[model samples]
Target: MTLDRRTFLGTAAVATLAAPMVRAQGKPKVVVIGGGAGGATAARYIAKDSDGAIDVTLVEPTRKYYTCFFSNLYIGGFRDLASIGHTYGTLASDYGINVVHDWAVGVDRDAMTVTLTGGDTLPYDKLILSPGIDFVDGAVPGWDITAQNAMPHAYKAGSQSELLKAQVEAMPEGGLYAMVAPPNPYRCPPGPYERISMVAHVLKQTNPSAKILIVDPKQSFSKQALFEEGWQKHYGGMVERIGPDFGGANVSVNPDEMTVDIDGAVEKVDVCNVIPAMKAGRIAELAGVTDGNWAPVNASDMSTKADPDVYVLGDASAQGDMPKSGFSANSQAKVCANAVRGALTGSRVFPAKYANTCWSLIDENDGVKVGATYEATPDKIAKVDGFISQTGEDADLRKATYEESVGWYAGITADMFG
Candidate 1:
């Protein structure tokens, strides 16, 4: 029997049993929805760790996934779309995962089956939901899908990202680029700032006369000091930030008009990226797994509060103190995978350590990162020690860190998809 890297990592930590002994007459069927950071990891781990004792199926609309982690680089012209986009062909060909290319329309929790948009129903003994997030329609009034055609959010990862990049490229040399940052509890706390940094990097070369404005609802943000320092040092006078004190710059937008009403002041811009407030994907609501915007789950195993056999990870799950980032989602998926394995095989699940490190580019050669490890308590996730990054120590170290981020992306994508 051949095992892929994902399966090998999952099974390597477990004690070995005879192959025949592990095989059951009828193995438990696990169906996972979404194949982004969380769902892909959980599906791969369950199939791999069970060592042919579990039947795993993954349902996702796209055959390829483009990560938001390094997408800023793509916007800044450092990386290409192909480099960031990954395929699940490896997951299907190497790991024996039944990859279903379809959108899940609804989930029938009572029947324990997932209903597809095409009218097929997949029954599962255990289901994992990690559908990521969706934009809140009315969070910013006047912003809808049609309006998004003119002003791109570029938050979701694929076409939107490309559209934003195209708009930025087509901008006049002295034009303005405005990005409205969403409120808290959104995916990637530091993402908007990093996006500004990358866009500034591009403007520095192409459109030095252009300026970037960030209209934020909050005064303070993640990595505030570092980002400010970088902006002053690298792209001084080219970037401006208006926080809550300045009337919050809170606005209802008119996407069709390409205009925003900020605190009774209406302004029109050449390019706008309105990142709306977010919630767990619609599937969470359909499954009755969400409380408000997020799915409540046990911190220990990531099992849903509504159903113990159903686990939720990724941006959709409510993890206290941990921001919604891909690295965090990947770590949570591993813990959830272990918990599901324990429940299926009647084995003990030891306490696990979750680690997350997210790197943001301050410029092409400079970067900053925040990392932490956590121990799961009964109700919430508590941070552990020994999780810090190198401060403004040396120029050489910053350059090396930027290079390391590329390696991390490769390693993480391999861990999740390989």
Candidate 2:
């Protein structure tokens, strides 16, 4: 169901609405860093639910947001580039939010202020950071952001996705395409496999003889059986995956030579996609909330372990059991929003529960999904129940799953932006 912001804010039976509004200071300012699923959802929900009782500001450098979730479909020729782009107009005008297009450079916990690139300081009663993932420096030998034009990671989902698709389309007949997959605990666990499926779909229709190779660090991956089955059925003999046991762990690349070295064996490729090990975005580190690569958070409300007034969400948060997916971020945002509002406006705080589902398309009308419900524990967000799509599903069921994903995309974007 679509979250009608007006109705939810007006008549959600919030216990605090009956009493006089009480804020920590003034309207209880909430400053959110980043504008992806988690940040956007958090900002919108806090502003809309408070009904002018809270002042919310969202910090995002980009004027338009392109979702990483369905970007692979665009690469596969299932969607166009403009279809995935969204604007913050609605969040600003309709939700009564201050949407600032500026980079957040620093966070001073002592003063409870965020410094922007434009030299403006924003104060916050509660701060939410959802800055997404950034690749570890030098994680992939011979590959870095400077070589992105030649070898695109396209994980952040914007111009990089367009560049990757262009490179794929421009590949010569029978050209080789290679991918260096990331290790565990990365954003979108099934993303790389889904990307492979999309790439295979494109090559099958465009360059039938083109070869695809995957150099993976992990021996096993999310939905491994389902993906392997689909590859065998749809693109037999066209794709080859080398796992760590087969020297996938010992690999390097040269963008200039278009070569991949796998255990001292070199293979030349026309295009390369290198997904390196990731960490929380720079702002999270600047906030001093990160423990090495990611910021640990209290699962019940996404509050940072280092600071109670601050929250971390989405890929940057080391919340347990949730596989850094957009659905997980959106769910976590709701729980966070509730907690923040309760703290600011004395609302009824409900028990924290979260849920997430990830869907991957293997082919046209062929989709698989994994989903779970979770609860907050002393240690982490522990899984309560879960299910996954099996390999050998009927065509109708797969089609239904795919259709369900389409609906979810619509529902979630609306929930986040509106």
Query: Which structure among the candidates has the greatest TM-score?
Result: 2
Q: lDDT for every model?
A: 0.83, 0.92
Report model 2's TM-score to 2 decimal places: 0.96
Q: Which stretches of candidate 2 lie over 4 Å from their true place?
A: 1-19
Please provide, for model 2 over 78-196, each residue's C-alpha lDDT reduced to its tens digit, 9 standing for 90 to 100. Answer: 88889889999999999999999999999999999999999999999999999999999998899998999899999999999999999999999999999999998899999999999
Question: Model 1, which residues run further than 4 Å from truth?
Answer: 1-25, 386-391
User: Which structure among the candidates has the greatest lDDT?
Assistant: 2
TM-score of each: 0.94, 0.96
Tell me the RMSD of model 2 versus the true structure: 2.6
Clashing residue pairs for model 2: none
- Residue 75 of model 2 has an lDDT of 97
Q: How many steric overlaps does candidate 2 have? A: 0
